[model samples]
Target: MTIRMQPDYRLSIAQIVPRTEAEGPGVRFALWFQGCPLRCPGCCNPEMLPFEGGTPMALGEIVRQMGQGLESHGIEGITLLGGEPLAHAPGAAALARAAREIGLSVMVFTGYTLEEARQMPDTAVAELLAHTDILVDGPYVREQPDSTRRWIGSTNQRVHFLSERYRADDPCWRQPNTLEIRLREGELAVNGFPARSAVGLWRRPPWRTPRDP
Candidate 1:
Protein backbone atom coordinates (compact mmCIF):
# COMPACT_ATOMS: atom_id res chain seq x y z
CA MET A 1 0.00 0.00 0.00
CA THR A 2 1.27 3.41 -0.95
CA ILE A 3 0.42 6.37 1.25
CA ARG A 4 -0.75 9.61 -0.25
CA MET A 5 1.83 12.26 0.47
CA GLN A 6 0.80 15.35 2.38
CA PRO A 7 3.68 17.64 3.24
CA ASP A 8 1.47 19.88 5.35
CA TYR A 9 -0.04 17.12 7.45
CA ARG A 10 -1.39 17.84 10.91
CA LEU A 11 -2.50 15.73 13.87
CA SER A 12 -5.36 16.00 16.30
CA ILE A 13 -3.49 15.39 19.53
CA ALA A 14 -4.97 14.27 22.83
CA GLN A 15 -1.68 14.54 24.65
CA ILE A 16 2.06 14.69 24.03
CA VAL A 17 4.94 13.98 26.35
CA PRO A 18 8.17 15.35 25.03
CA ARG A 19 10.15 12.89 27.09
CA THR A 20 8.79 9.97 29.02
CA GLU A 21 10.43 6.78 30.27
CA ALA A 22 7.06 5.20 31.03
CA GLU A 23 5.90 4.95 27.41
CA GLY A 24 8.53 2.60 25.91
CA PRO A 25 12.07 1.27 26.17
CA GLY A 26 14.30 4.11 27.25
CA VAL A 27 13.14 7.72 27.20
CA ARG A 28 10.87 8.57 24.28
CA PHE A 29 8.56 11.16 22.82
CA ALA A 30 5.04 9.82 23.19
CA LEU A 31 1.94 11.01 21.38
CA TRP A 32 -1.69 10.20 22.04
CA PHE A 33 -3.82 10.87 19.01
CA GLN A 34 -7.38 12.12 19.43
CA GLY A 35 -10.45 9.92 18.77
CA CYS A 36 -11.05 6.17 18.34
CA PRO A 37 -13.80 3.97 16.96
CA LEU A 38 -13.40 0.96 19.24
CA ARG A 39 -15.15 1.38 22.55
CA CYS A 40 -13.17 -1.06 24.61
CA PRO A 41 -15.05 -1.19 27.89
CA GLY A 42 -13.20 0.81 30.52
CA CYS A 43 -10.99 2.60 28.05
CA CYS A 44 -8.17 4.31 29.95
CA ASN A 45 -8.61 7.63 28.18
CA PRO A 46 -12.31 8.12 27.60
CA GLU A 47 -11.85 11.84 27.08
CA MET A 48 -10.17 11.00 23.80
CA LEU A 49 -13.11 9.08 22.32
CA PRO A 50 -14.78 12.05 20.64
CA PHE A 51 -13.31 13.14 17.30
CA GLU A 52 -14.03 16.83 17.78
CA GLY A 53 -11.85 18.11 20.61
CA GLY A 54 -8.03 18.23 20.63
CA THR A 55 -5.24 20.52 19.57
CA PRO A 56 -4.76 20.66 15.84
CA MET A 57 -0.98 20.62 15.63
CA ALA A 58 1.21 20.85 12.60
CA LEU A 59 3.38 17.88 11.68
CA GLY A 60 6.48 20.07 11.59
CA GLU A 61 5.92 21.22 15.18
CA ILE A 62 5.61 17.64 16.41
CA VAL A 63 8.78 16.66 14.57
CA ARG A 64 10.59 19.61 16.07
CA GLN A 65 9.60 18.61 19.58
CA MET A 66 10.77 15.04 18.85
CA GLY A 67 14.19 16.34 17.83
CA GLN A 68 14.30 18.40 21.01
CA GLY A 69 13.55 15.28 23.02
CA LEU A 70 16.48 13.54 21.38
CA GLU A 71 18.86 16.38 22.13
CA SER A 72 17.66 17.20 25.65
CA HIS A 73 16.73 13.80 27.03
CA GLY A 74 18.71 11.52 24.74
CA ILE A 75 15.54 9.67 23.82
CA GLU A 76 15.97 6.55 21.69
CA GLY A 77 12.50 6.45 20.18
CA ILE A 78 8.94 7.73 19.73
CA THR A 79 5.79 5.91 20.85
CA LEU A 80 2.39 6.39 19.26
CA LEU A 81 -0.68 5.56 21.33
CA GLY A 82 -4.28 6.74 21.24
CA GLY A 83 -7.18 7.20 21.09
CA GLU A 84 -5.98 4.77 18.36
CA PRO A 85 -2.87 5.20 16.23
CA LEU A 86 -4.30 3.36 13.24
CA ALA A 87 -7.26 5.72 13.36
CA HIS A 88 -4.79 8.56 12.86
CA ALA A 89 -2.50 6.68 10.46
CA PRO A 90 -1.50 9.50 8.17
CA GLY A 91 0.00 11.73 10.85
CA ALA A 92 1.33 8.74 12.74
CA ALA A 93 3.13 7.56 9.62
CA ALA A 94 4.52 11.02 9.07
CA LEU A 95 5.75 11.16 12.65
CA ALA A 96 7.25 7.65 12.36
CA ARG A 97 9.09 8.62 9.22
CA ALA A 98 10.41 11.77 10.85
CA ALA A 99 11.58 9.71 13.82
CA ARG A 100 13.45 7.34 11.51
CA GLU A 101 15.02 10.20 9.59
CA ILE A 102 16.41 11.46 12.90
CA GLY A 103 17.79 7.94 13.70
CA LEU A 104 15.17 7.25 16.38
CA SER A 105 13.24 4.02 16.63
CA VAL A 106 9.45 3.95 16.29
CA MET A 107 7.05 2.08 18.55
CA VAL A 108 3.28 2.05 18.22
CA PHE A 109 0.39 0.71 20.28
CA THR A 110 -2.62 -0.14 18.15
CA GLY A 111 -5.99 -1.62 19.06
CA TYR A 112 -6.02 -3.58 15.80
CA THR A 113 -4.12 -6.86 15.58
CA LEU A 114 -1.31 -7.02 13.06
CA GLU A 115 -3.31 -9.34 10.79
CA GLU A 116 -6.35 -7.08 10.96
CA ALA A 117 -4.33 -3.96 10.32
CA ARG A 118 -2.63 -5.53 7.31
CA GLN A 119 -5.96 -6.56 5.87
CA MET A 120 -7.33 -3.01 6.13
CA PRO A 121 -7.42 -0.94 2.95
CA ASP A 122 -5.82 2.13 4.55
CA THR A 123 -2.56 2.85 2.77
CA ALA A 124 -1.26 4.99 5.62
CA VAL A 125 -1.66 2.05 8.00
CA ALA A 126 0.74 0.04 5.89
CA GLU A 127 3.14 2.95 5.74
CA LEU A 128 3.00 3.36 9.52
CA LEU A 129 3.65 -0.36 10.00
CA ALA A 130 6.54 -0.26 7.57
CA HIS A 131 8.32 2.38 9.64
CA THR A 132 7.42 0.92 13.02
CA ASP A 133 10.17 -0.92 14.90
CA ILE A 134 7.83 -2.29 17.54
CA LEU A 135 4.07 -2.72 17.63
CA VAL A 136 1.88 -3.60 20.63
CA ASP A 137 -1.39 -4.85 19.13
CA GLY A 138 -4.89 -5.89 20.19
CA PRO A 139 -7.74 -4.27 22.09
CA TYR A 140 -7.29 -3.55 25.76
CA VAL A 141 -9.17 -6.26 27.62
CA ARG A 142 -9.95 -4.80 31.03
CA GLU A 143 -10.80 -8.22 32.45
CA GLN A 144 -7.32 -9.52 31.67
CA PRO A 145 -4.91 -6.96 33.02
CA ASP A 146 -1.26 -7.61 32.24
CA SER A 147 1.23 -7.78 35.09
CA THR A 148 4.04 -9.64 33.36
CA ARG A 149 4.87 -7.20 30.57
CA ARG A 150 6.23 -3.74 31.29
CA TRP A 151 4.07 -1.65 28.93
CA ILE A 152 1.25 -3.96 27.90
CA GLY A 153 -2.26 -3.31 29.20
CA SER A 154 -3.71 -6.82 28.97
CA THR A 155 -2.76 -10.43 28.31
CA ASN A 156 -4.69 -10.40 25.03
CA GLN A 157 -2.28 -7.88 23.55
CA ARG A 158 0.82 -9.13 21.69
CA VAL A 159 4.11 -7.43 21.08
CA HIS A 160 5.56 -7.62 17.59
CA PHE A 161 9.13 -6.60 16.86
CA LEU A 162 8.40 -5.39 13.36
CA SER A 163 12.04 -4.45 12.88
CA GLU A 164 15.35 -5.63 14.36
CA ARG A 165 15.61 -2.52 16.53
CA TYR A 166 14.44 -4.45 19.61
CA ARG A 167 14.21 -8.06 20.73
CA ALA A 168 11.97 -10.19 22.94
CA ASP A 169 14.83 -10.96 25.29
CA ASP A 170 15.76 -7.34 25.81
CA PRO A 171 16.28 -6.60 29.53
CA CYS A 172 13.95 -3.61 29.30
CA TRP A 173 10.94 -5.83 28.62
CA ARG A 174 11.40 -7.55 31.96
CA GLN A 175 11.17 -4.37 33.95
CA PRO A 176 8.02 -3.44 35.84
CA ASN A 177 5.59 -0.92 34.41
CA THR A 178 5.68 2.53 35.97
CA LEU A 179 3.37 5.51 36.12
CA GLU A 180 4.61 9.07 35.76
CA ILE A 181 3.05 12.07 37.41
CA ARG A 182 4.06 15.46 36.17
CA LEU A 183 3.41 18.72 38.00
CA ARG A 184 4.39 21.41 35.57
CA GLU A 185 3.18 24.99 35.82
CA GLY A 186 0.65 23.86 38.41
CA GLU A 187 -0.88 21.29 36.06
CA LEU A 188 -1.08 17.70 37.17
CA ALA A 189 -0.78 15.08 34.45
CA VAL A 190 -0.37 11.35 34.82
CA ASN A 191 0.48 8.62 32.34
CA GLY A 192 1.80 5.05 32.01
CA PHE A 193 0.39 1.75 33.20
CA PRO A 194 -0.53 1.76 36.86
CA ALA A 195 -2.22 -0.62 39.23
CA ARG A 196 -6.02 -0.68 39.03
CA SER A 197 -6.32 0.67 42.56
CA ALA A 198 -4.00 3.58 41.80
CA VAL A 199 -5.98 4.86 38.83
CA GLY A 200 -8.30 7.15 40.81
CA LEU A 201 -5.58 8.86 42.81
CA TRP A 202 -4.42 11.15 40.06
CA ARG A 203 -6.82 13.70 38.63
CA ARG A 204 -6.29 15.86 35.60
CA PRO A 205 -5.59 19.49 36.29
CA PRO A 206 -8.62 21.70 35.71
CA TRP A 207 -6.77 24.09 33.44
CA ARG A 208 -5.37 21.63 30.94
CA THR A 209 -6.23 22.58 27.40
CA PRO A 210 -7.34 19.93 24.88
CA ARG A 211 -8.10 17.63 27.85
CA ASP A 212 -6.93 14.00 28.39
CA PRO A 213 -8.99 11.03 27.45
Candidate 2:
Protein backbone atom coordinates (compact mmCIF):
# COMPACT_ATOMS: atom_id res chain seq x y z
CA MET A 1 0.00 0.00 0.00
CA THR A 2 1.13 3.53 -0.73
CA ILE A 3 0.53 6.57 1.45
CA ARG A 4 -0.43 9.91 -0.03
CA MET A 5 0.49 13.21 1.59
CA GLN A 6 -1.29 16.53 1.39
CA PRO A 7 0.61 19.63 0.27
CA ASP A 8 0.87 22.39 2.83
CA TYR A 9 -0.75 25.68 1.95
CA ARG A 10 1.19 28.89 2.46
CA LEU A 11 -0.56 31.36 4.75
CA SER A 12 -1.18 34.99 3.92
CA ILE A 13 -0.40 37.00 7.03
CA ALA A 14 -1.94 40.47 7.01
CA GLN A 15 0.32 41.68 9.79
CA ILE A 16 2.34 40.51 12.72
CA VAL A 17 1.62 42.59 15.86
CA PRO A 18 3.87 41.74 18.72
CA ARG A 19 4.36 42.23 22.46
CA THR A 20 0.75 43.14 23.06
CA GLU A 21 -0.39 43.25 26.68
CA ALA A 22 -4.10 43.18 25.84
CA GLU A 23 -4.79 40.20 23.54
CA GLY A 24 -4.87 37.33 25.99
CA PRO A 25 -3.15 35.14 28.58
CA GLY A 26 0.01 37.27 28.73
CA VAL A 27 2.43 39.27 26.64
CA ARG A 28 2.08 37.47 23.30
CA PHE A 29 2.99 37.61 19.66
CA ALA A 30 -0.14 37.82 17.52
CA LEU A 31 -0.56 36.83 13.89
CA TRP A 32 -3.34 38.53 11.99
CA PHE A 33 -4.11 36.54 8.86
CA GLN A 34 -5.61 38.00 5.72
CA GLY A 35 -9.19 37.47 4.42
CA CYS A 36 -12.39 37.65 6.42
CA PRO A 37 -15.91 37.47 5.05
CA LEU A 38 -17.74 38.40 8.24
CA ARG A 39 -16.67 42.07 8.01
CA CYS A 40 -18.03 42.97 11.37
CA PRO A 41 -18.78 46.68 11.71
CA GLY A 42 -16.30 48.83 13.61
CA CYS A 43 -13.64 46.14 13.53
CA CYS A 44 -10.52 47.68 15.07
CA ASN A 45 -8.15 46.65 12.29
CA PRO A 46 -10.32 47.20 9.27
CA GLU A 47 -7.14 47.29 7.21
CA MET A 48 -7.04 43.49 7.45
CA LEU A 49 -10.23 43.21 5.41
CA PRO A 50 -8.54 42.71 2.05
CA PHE A 51 -7.29 39.20 1.27
CA GLU A 52 -4.50 40.12 -1.12
CA GLY A 53 -2.62 42.65 0.99
CA GLY A 54 -0.56 40.46 3.29
CA THR A 55 2.71 38.67 2.59
CA PRO A 56 2.64 34.97 1.74
CA MET A 57 4.58 33.12 4.41
CA ALA A 58 5.54 29.47 4.57
CA LEU A 59 4.79 27.31 7.62
CA GLY A 60 8.45 26.81 8.50
CA GLU A 61 9.20 30.54 8.44
CA ILE A 62 6.19 31.27 10.63
CA VAL A 63 7.16 28.68 13.22
CA ARG A 64 10.74 29.93 13.23
CA GLN A 65 9.59 33.48 13.83
CA MET A 66 7.37 32.34 16.70
CA GLY A 67 10.25 30.41 18.25
CA GLN A 68 12.50 33.44 17.92
CA GLY A 69 9.81 35.57 19.52
CA LEU A 70 9.43 33.17 22.43
CA GLU A 71 13.19 33.03 22.99
CA SER A 72 13.81 36.75 22.63
CA HIS A 73 11.05 37.88 24.97
CA GLY A 74 10.18 34.90 27.18
CA ILE A 75 6.52 35.42 26.23
CA GLU A 76 3.84 33.10 27.52
CA GLY A 77 2.24 31.92 24.28
CA ILE A 78 1.11 32.80 20.77
CA THR A 79 -2.39 34.04 19.93
CA LEU A 80 -3.74 33.67 16.37
CA LEU A 81 -6.00 36.55 15.36
CA GLY A 82 -7.19 37.20 11.89
CA GLY A 83 -9.11 38.28 9.15
CA GLU A 84 -10.39 34.97 10.66
CA PRO A 85 -8.13 32.02 11.48
CA LEU A 86 -10.76 29.57 10.28
CA ALA A 87 -10.51 31.17 6.84
CA HIS A 88 -7.13 29.57 6.27
CA ALA A 89 -7.67 26.43 8.26
CA PRO A 90 -5.05 24.20 6.71
CA GLY A 91 -2.24 26.70 7.06
CA ALA A 92 -3.38 27.78 10.50
CA ALA A 93 -3.61 24.16 11.63
CA ALA A 94 -0.10 23.51 10.41
CA LEU A 95 1.11 26.58 12.30
CA ALA A 96 -0.72 25.58 15.48
CA ARG A 97 0.63 22.02 15.30
CA ALA A 98 4.13 23.38 14.95
CA ALA A 99 3.62 25.73 17.86
CA ARG A 100 2.47 22.82 20.00
CA GLU A 101 5.56 20.83 18.99
CA ILE A 102 7.64 23.72 20.30
CA GLY A 103 5.82 23.58 23.65
CA LEU A 104 3.66 26.64 23.16
CA SER A 105 -0.07 26.48 23.79
CA VAL A 106 -2.34 27.95 21.13
CA MET A 107 -5.17 30.45 21.54
CA VAL A 108 -7.29 31.25 18.50
CA PHE A 109 -9.71 34.14 18.06
CA THR A 110 -12.35 33.49 15.44
CA GLY A 111 -15.50 35.16 14.24
CA TYR A 112 -17.10 31.74 13.80
CA THR A 113 -19.22 30.49 16.67
CA LEU A 114 -18.36 27.19 18.35
CA GLU A 115 -21.28 25.56 16.57
CA GLU A 116 -20.12 27.04 13.28
CA ALA A 117 -16.64 25.57 13.68
CA ARG A 118 -18.18 22.18 14.34
CA GLN A 119 -20.08 22.56 11.09
CA MET A 120 -17.20 23.92 8.99
CA PRO A 121 -16.84 22.16 5.64
CA ASP A 122 -13.09 22.14 5.91
CA THR A 123 -11.71 19.34 8.05
CA ALA A 124 -8.70 21.53 8.64
CA VAL A 125 -10.66 23.72 11.02
CA ALA A 126 -11.36 20.73 13.20
CA GLU A 127 -7.71 19.73 13.02
CA LEU A 128 -6.73 23.24 14.08
CA LEU A 129 -9.25 23.13 16.90
CA ALA A 130 -7.84 19.83 18.11
CA HIS A 131 -4.46 21.46 18.44
CA THR A 132 -5.84 24.66 19.89
CA ASP A 133 -6.04 24.77 23.69
CA ILE A 134 -8.39 27.72 24.02
CA LEU A 135 -10.78 29.02 21.39
CA VAL A 136 -12.52 32.42 21.69
CA ASP A 137 -15.38 32.04 19.24
CA GLY A 138 -18.06 34.41 17.86
CA PRO A 139 -18.46 37.59 15.87
CA TYR A 140 -18.13 40.88 17.72
CA VAL A 141 -21.40 42.63 18.62
CA ARG A 142 -21.13 46.39 19.14
CA GLU A 143 -23.97 46.41 21.67
CA GLN A 144 -22.44 43.50 23.62
CA PRO A 145 -19.05 45.13 24.26
CA ASP A 146 -16.11 43.88 26.30
CA SER A 147 -16.25 46.72 28.80
CA THR A 148 -12.56 46.38 29.61
CA ARG A 149 -13.01 42.67 30.03
CA ARG A 150 -9.99 40.39 30.09
CA TRP A 151 -10.26 38.18 26.99
CA ILE A 152 -13.44 38.41 25.01
CA GLY A 153 -14.83 41.23 22.87
CA SER A 154 -18.55 40.58 23.43
CA THR A 155 -20.94 38.89 25.81
CA ASN A 156 -22.05 36.25 23.33
CA GLN A 157 -18.71 34.66 22.47
CA ARG A 158 -17.81 31.48 24.28
CA VAL A 159 -14.46 29.92 25.16
CA HIS A 160 -14.29 26.22 24.29
CA PHE A 161 -11.89 23.58 25.52
CA LEU A 162 -10.82 21.26 22.70
CA SER A 163 -8.34 19.12 24.52
CA GLU A 164 -8.88 15.93 26.51
CA ARG A 165 -8.41 18.12 29.53
CA TYR A 166 -12.11 18.92 29.46
CA ARG A 167 -13.95 16.44 31.65
CA ALA A 168 -17.10 14.81 30.33
CA ASP A 169 -19.31 17.05 32.52
CA ASP A 170 -17.37 20.18 33.28
CA PRO A 171 -19.70 23.20 33.26
CA CYS A 172 -16.91 25.78 33.47
CA TRP A 173 -15.36 24.42 30.30
CA ARG A 174 -18.78 24.14 28.68
CA GLN A 175 -20.36 27.54 29.36
CA PRO A 176 -18.24 30.29 30.85
CA ASN A 177 -19.93 33.59 31.73
CA THR A 178 -19.30 36.88 30.01
CA LEU A 179 -17.11 39.21 32.08
CA GLU A 180 -18.26 42.54 33.53
CA ILE A 181 -15.78 45.29 34.33
CA ARG A 182 -15.24 48.70 35.95
CA LEU A 183 -12.04 50.37 34.84
CA ARG A 184 -9.77 51.77 37.53
CA GLU A 185 -9.58 54.85 35.30
CA GLY A 186 -12.93 55.98 36.87
CA GLU A 187 -16.52 55.44 35.76
CA LEU A 188 -17.24 51.94 34.46
CA ALA A 189 -16.22 51.51 30.85
CA VAL A 190 -18.58 49.02 29.26
CA ASN A 191 -17.41 46.48 26.73
CA GLY A 192 -15.87 47.99 23.55
CA PHE A 193 -15.18 51.36 25.19
CA PRO A 194 -11.63 52.71 25.25
CA ALA A 195 -9.54 51.34 28.10
CA ARG A 196 -10.25 54.36 30.24
CA SER A 197 -12.96 56.10 32.23
CA ALA A 198 -16.47 55.99 30.84
CA VAL A 199 -17.52 59.10 28.97
CA GLY A 200 -20.56 61.06 30.17
CA LEU A 201 -23.23 61.79 27.57
CA TRP A 202 -23.43 65.31 28.94
CA ARG A 203 -19.84 66.03 27.87
CA ARG A 204 -20.76 66.28 24.20
CA PRO A 205 -22.17 69.61 23.10
CA PRO A 206 -25.30 69.24 20.95
CA TRP A 207 -24.54 72.48 19.12
CA ARG A 208 -21.12 71.42 17.88
CA THR A 209 -20.73 71.19 14.12
CA PRO A 210 -19.49 68.00 12.46
CA ARG A 211 -16.49 69.53 10.67
CA ASP A 212 -15.95 72.76 12.60
CA PRO A 213 -15.91 73.26 16.38
Candidate 3:
Protein backbone atom coordinates (compact mmCIF):
# COMPACT_ATOMS: atom_id res chain seq x y z
CA MET A 1 0.00 0.00 0.00
CA THR A 2 1.22 3.47 -0.86
CA ILE A 3 1.30 5.86 2.06
CA ARG A 4 1.01 9.60 1.56
CA MET A 5 2.91 12.09 3.62
CA GLN A 6 1.30 15.19 5.02
CA PRO A 7 2.03 18.41 3.15
CA ASP A 8 4.00 19.79 6.07
CA TYR A 9 5.36 16.40 7.21
CA ARG A 10 4.74 17.52 10.76
CA LEU A 11 2.79 15.72 13.49
CA SER A 12 1.42 17.30 16.63
CA ILE A 13 2.42 14.88 19.36
CA ALA A 14 1.31 14.69 22.97
CA GLN A 15 4.08 12.36 24.04
CA ILE A 16 6.47 9.61 22.96
CA VAL A 17 7.76 6.92 25.23
CA PRO A 18 10.83 5.14 23.86
CA ARG A 19 9.69 1.82 25.25
CA THR A 20 6.63 0.35 26.89
CA GLU A 21 5.41 -3.19 27.38
CA ALA A 22 1.83 -2.14 28.10
CA GLU A 23 0.83 -0.64 24.77
CA GLY A 24 0.71 -3.70 22.55
CA PRO A 25 1.63 -7.35 21.99
CA GLY A 26 5.22 -6.82 23.00
CA VAL A 27 7.56 -4.11 24.13
CA ARG A 28 6.91 -1.15 21.87
CA PHE A 29 7.72 2.46 21.23
CA ALA A 30 4.53 4.38 21.94
CA LEU A 31 3.57 7.60 20.16
CA TRP A 32 0.58 9.61 21.36
CA PHE A 33 -0.47 12.33 18.97
CA GLN A 34 -2.14 15.52 20.11
CA GLY A 35 -5.65 16.68 19.16
CA CYS A 36 -8.95 14.85 19.13
CA PRO A 37 -12.38 15.88 17.94
CA LEU A 38 -14.33 13.14 19.68
CA ARG A 39 -14.36 13.83 23.35
CA CYS A 40 -15.41 10.33 24.29
CA PRO A 41 -16.82 10.16 27.77
CA GLY A 42 -14.32 8.73 30.25
CA CYS A 43 -11.35 9.26 27.98
CA CYS A 44 -8.15 8.32 29.77
CA ASN A 45 -5.86 10.87 28.21
CA PRO A 46 -7.97 13.99 28.28
CA GLU A 47 -4.84 16.10 28.44
CA MET A 48 -4.18 15.16 24.84
CA LEU A 49 -7.56 16.33 23.54
CA PRO A 50 -6.65 19.95 22.85
CA PHE A 51 -5.87 20.56 19.20
CA GLU A 52 -3.66 23.59 19.87
CA GLY A 53 -1.37 21.91 22.35
CA GLY A 54 1.49 19.41 21.91
CA THR A 55 4.81 19.83 20.20
CA PRO A 56 4.80 20.02 16.41
CA MET A 57 7.44 17.55 15.31
CA ALA A 58 8.87 16.67 11.95
CA LEU A 59 7.89 13.27 10.61
CA GLY A 60 11.51 12.52 9.90
CA GLU A 61 12.49 13.28 13.48
CA ILE A 62 9.74 11.07 14.84
CA VAL A 63 10.78 8.23 12.55
CA ARG A 64 14.41 8.73 13.52
CA GLN A 65 13.45 8.39 17.14
CA MET A 66 11.52 5.20 16.43
CA GLY A 67 14.53 3.78 14.65
CA GLN A 68 16.71 4.60 17.59
CA GLY A 69 14.17 3.03 19.91
CA LEU A 70 14.27 -0.20 17.94
CA GLU A 71 18.04 -0.36 18.02
CA SER A 72 18.49 0.73 21.63
CA HIS A 73 15.58 -0.99 23.28
CA GLY A 74 15.00 -3.97 20.97
CA ILE A 75 11.36 -3.08 20.76
CA GLU A 76 9.03 -5.39 18.87
CA GLY A 77 6.82 -2.70 17.40
CA ILE A 78 5.28 0.76 17.51
CA THR A 79 1.91 1.55 19.07
CA LEU A 80 0.12 4.67 17.87
CA LEU A 81 -2.13 6.14 20.54
CA GLY A 82 -3.80 9.50 20.67
CA GLY A 83 -6.10 12.05 20.59
CA GLU A 84 -7.69 10.09 17.75
CA PRO A 85 -4.82 9.06 15.49
CA LEU A 86 -7.17 8.98 12.52
CA ALA A 87 -7.79 12.70 12.92
CA HIS A 88 -4.20 13.24 11.85
CA ALA A 89 -4.31 10.66 9.09
CA PRO A 90 -1.53 11.88 6.87
CA GLY A 91 1.15 12.22 9.51
CA ALA A 92 0.07 9.07 11.32
CA ALA A 93 0.08 7.21 8.01
CA ALA A 94 3.57 8.47 7.28
CA LEU A 95 4.78 7.34 10.69
CA ALA A 96 3.22 3.89 10.28
CA ARG A 97 4.81 3.52 6.86
CA ALA A 98 8.24 4.40 8.23
CA ALA A 99 7.93 1.96 11.10
CA ARG A 100 6.87 -0.91 8.82
CA GLU A 101 9.71 -0.24 6.38
CA ILE A 102 12.07 -1.15 9.20
CA GLY A 103 10.05 -4.35 9.98
CA LEU A 104 8.24 -3.08 13.06
CA SER A 105 4.63 -4.07 13.53
CA VAL A 106 2.17 -1.20 13.83
CA MET A 107 -0.71 -1.16 16.30
CA VAL A 108 -3.12 1.72 16.52
CA PHE A 109 -5.74 2.75 19.09
CA THR A 110 -8.49 5.01 17.84
CA GLY A 111 -11.90 6.27 18.78
CA TYR A 112 -13.30 5.49 15.33
CA THR A 113 -14.82 2.10 14.68
CA LEU A 114 -13.14 -0.01 12.00
CA GLU A 115 -16.18 0.26 9.72
CA GLU A 116 -16.40 4.01 10.26
CA ALA A 117 -12.72 4.45 9.58
CA ARG A 118 -12.97 2.42 6.38
CA GLN A 119 -15.66 4.76 5.12
CA MET A 120 -13.53 7.88 5.66
CA PRO A 121 -13.07 9.94 2.49
CA ASP A 122 -9.36 10.43 3.11
CA THR A 123 -7.11 7.89 1.40
CA ALA A 124 -4.49 8.39 4.07
CA VAL A 125 -6.75 6.85 6.64
CA ALA A 126 -7.10 3.74 4.52
CA GLU A 127 -3.39 3.65 3.93
CA LEU A 128 -2.74 3.89 7.65
CA LEU A 129 -5.14 1.04 8.31
CA ALA A 130 -3.50 -1.06 5.65
CA HIS A 131 -0.15 -0.82 7.38
CA THR A 132 -1.57 -1.47 10.80
CA ASP A 133 -1.17 -4.99 12.17
CA ILE A 134 -3.61 -4.58 15.02
CA LEU A 135 -6.25 -1.91 15.51
CA VAL A 136 -8.22 -1.38 18.72
CA ASP A 137 -11.21 0.77 17.82
CA GLY A 138 -14.28 2.40 19.36
CA PRO A 139 -15.06 5.30 21.64
CA TYR A 140 -14.35 4.91 25.34
CA VAL A 141 -17.70 4.41 27.06
CA ARG A 142 -17.71 5.04 30.78
CA GLU A 143 -20.52 2.54 31.19
CA GLN A 144 -18.53 -0.20 29.52
CA PRO A 145 -15.12 0.12 31.10
CA ASP A 146 -13.20 -3.13 30.54
CA SER A 147 -10.74 -4.75 32.88
CA THR A 148 -10.38 -8.23 31.42
CA ARG A 149 -9.10 -7.18 28.04
CA ARG A 150 -5.49 -6.37 27.42
CA TRP A 151 -4.56 -3.11 25.66
CA ILE A 152 -8.13 -1.88 25.43
CA GLY A 153 -10.17 0.53 27.53
CA SER A 154 -13.86 -0.38 27.22
CA THR A 155 -15.84 -3.50 26.46
CA ASN A 156 -17.39 -1.88 23.41
CA GLN A 157 -14.00 -1.45 21.77
CA ARG A 158 -13.03 -4.15 19.30
CA VAL A 159 -9.64 -5.46 18.39
CA HIS A 160 -9.11 -6.08 14.70
CA PHE A 161 -6.22 -8.20 13.58
CA LEU A 162 -5.56 -6.79 10.15
CA SER A 163 -2.42 -8.79 9.68
CA GLU A 164 -1.14 -12.20 10.79
CA ARG A 165 1.55 -10.77 13.03
CA TYR A 166 -0.65 -11.53 16.02
CA ARG A 167 -3.43 -14.02 16.59
CA ALA A 168 -6.79 -13.53 18.20
CA ASP A 169 -6.57 -16.91 19.83
CA ASP A 170 -3.51 -15.90 21.79
CA PRO A 171 -4.11 -15.84 25.53
CA CYS A 172 -1.96 -12.80 25.96
CA TRP A 173 -4.50 -10.56 24.29
CA ARG A 174 -7.32 -11.62 26.59
CA GLN A 175 -5.44 -11.50 29.86
CA PRO A 176 -6.53 -9.17 32.61
CA ASN A 177 -5.37 -5.57 32.58
CA THR A 178 -1.77 -4.80 33.46
CA LEU A 179 -0.24 -1.43 34.07
CA GLU A 180 3.27 -0.32 33.32
CA ILE A 181 4.71 2.60 35.23
CA ARG A 182 7.69 4.64 34.12
CA LEU A 183 9.61 7.13 36.16
CA ARG A 184 11.52 9.58 34.04
CA GLU A 185 13.10 12.87 34.95
CA GLY A 186 11.16 12.79 38.22
CA GLU A 187 7.87 12.42 36.41
CA LEU A 188 5.90 9.23 36.72
CA ALA A 189 3.77 8.11 33.80
CA VAL A 190 1.41 5.16 33.96
CA ASN A 191 0.46 3.23 30.86
CA GLY A 192 -2.12 0.52 30.17
CA PHE A 193 -5.71 -0.16 31.23
CA PRO A 194 -5.91 -0.49 34.96
CA ALA A 195 -8.40 -2.84 36.57
CA ARG A 196 -11.07 -1.36 38.85
CA SER A 197 -9.25 -2.64 41.89
CA ALA A 198 -5.98 -1.24 40.62
CA VAL A 199 -7.59 2.12 40.05
CA GLY A 200 -8.90 2.13 43.62
CA LEU A 201 -5.48 1.21 44.96
CA TRP A 202 -3.84 3.94 42.94
CA ARG A 203 -6.27 6.46 44.38
CA ARG A 204 -5.73 5.35 47.96
CA PRO A 205 -2.92 6.79 50.03
CA PRO A 206 -0.21 4.31 50.95
CA TRP A 207 0.08 5.54 54.52
CA ARG A 208 -3.63 5.23 55.34
CA THR A 209 -5.45 2.08 56.44
CA PRO A 210 -8.90 1.31 55.02
CA ARG A 211 -10.60 3.22 57.89
CA ASP A 212 -7.78 5.51 59.00
CA PRO A 213 -7.83 9.26 58.54
Instruction: Please report, in order, the local distance difference test score of every candidate based on alpha carbons.
Output: 0.82, 0.64, 0.78
What does each candidate score in C-alpha RMSD?
Answer: 3.5, 10.8, 7.4
Q: Return the TM-score for each candidate structure.
A: 0.90, 0.71, 0.87
Which pairs in model 2 have colliding backbones?
A: 145-191, 146-191, 146-192, 147-190, 147-191
2 or 3, which is superior by TM-score? 3
* Per-residue lDDT of model 3, residues 1-213, tens digit only: 577665457888877767777778777888888889998866667777889988888888778878887888888899998888999998889988888999999999999999999999999999999889999998988888776777677889999999998999887776666676644444455666672113411221111121111
lDDT of 2 by residue, 1-213 (tens): 111123334778875544444455555666778888887765655656678777776776667777876887666667888778999888888877877778777889999998989898788888888888878898877678764344566777777766653333544323332322333223332221242113211112111211211
Model 3 — TM-score against the truth?
0.87
Ranked candidates, highest lDDT first: 1, 3, 2
- Kindly give the stretch of ten consecutive residues in candidate 1 with the minimal lDDT sum: 204-213
Best by lDDT: 1
Model 3, 38: alpha-carbon shift in Å? 0.3
User: Which of the two candidates, 1 or 2, achieves a greater lDDT against the reference?
Assistant: 1
Off by over 4 Å in 2: 1-9, 164-213
lDDT of 1: 0.82
